[model samples]
Target: RGGPTACEFSFVLETLGSKIAAHEGEYADSDCYEILSELALLGRYELRALKLELRLAIEGVRADKFELPYRIASERTGCGFLILPVTREFHDRAFNALQSLSLASKHELELERQVGIGMWKNSEFVDVEWIFLEGGNPPDPDLEGRLAFSYPFRRVSEQRLPPIFT
Candidate 1:
């Protein structure tokens, strides 16, 4: 027999703020407009024109600020399924989770394949130019084509494992 609590209100505010700051008009056509409008009426949260101000502030921030590089992903080439890299801001936790699995010898291929599928599903910024497989020896040309694949995530290779400091 309970109604919405103070915590719920605070949660909504935090979520709205994140949505506002992370990407301005990302929610412009969504319910955020209505929620922000209603919340502005409360006058308790300093909501007076908050959404407009937020949109203006977010406009100053470029979209690239929200992008992350070298996300673990995969693709289906003429050669077959090849693990690769992609760039995006979301699904970071999923990428990190699968990357951890890829580090373990027992789970490398299986987990890498899963990460590739996850990227493939997103399909927003998938890259197939340079495929990254986890090993010193490259796969067969018939399996992965000589120029297509690269052995990344190694100490010697030009490619670097990330958590690349900003």
Candidate 2:
């Protein structure tokens, strides 16, 4: 009751693979599809079967699992359209992580990247937007954006920033 229902989870699992494949077509040939398909397989199983299946899949992909920098972006930042600043250090780590997972090639990791930000409320990601960052500065989410979200810039010192996925 606190999280997504089984039906909702099933729908997300069913659609997530196709959505990722369509948006990030380069990852289509990688182990990403197999990982996603493993997740999708959970939808076909009952609760008891789902647990066993998920455990097996987790074991299979344990070596490849990498953390996203969402926690770094979220901490101390309140609810709003955040101008999340991604440091060069974070960027490099992210690239290496993706490379390890075979999800990105050197050429595919551009100098400028469009980061997908999810807005969470009441334990759910209510809205998502792709914001482009160039030279570590994100475009004005309010001016160049059409979303109804508010903009609040939370500035953190580089020295205070923790090493990502450590």
Q: Estimate each model's TM-score.
A: 0.19, 0.23
lDDT of 2 at 112: 26
lDDT of the candidates, in the order given: 0.31, 0.29
Q: How many angstroms is residue 47 displaced in model 2 relative to the true structure, after the best TM-score fit?
A: 5.2
Q: Write the residue-wise lDDT of candidate 1 on 1-166 in tens digits.
A: 1333434334335755665566675544333454344344333223222223233222222232331222222112111121222234434554553344233311323322221211312353321111222333334344333223543332211222232133
* Clashing residue pairs in candidate 2 (N, C-alpha, C atoms within 3 angstroms): none
lDDT of 2 by residue, 1-166 (tens): 2343454335434444555667684544443354343333322222333333333322322333322322112122211111122233343343333332221111122222222222112122211112323233234444434222432222322223343342
- In angstroms, the error of model 1 at 129 is 36
Candidate 2, which segments miss by more than 4 Å at Cα?
1-4, 24-29, 40-166
TM-score of 2: 0.23
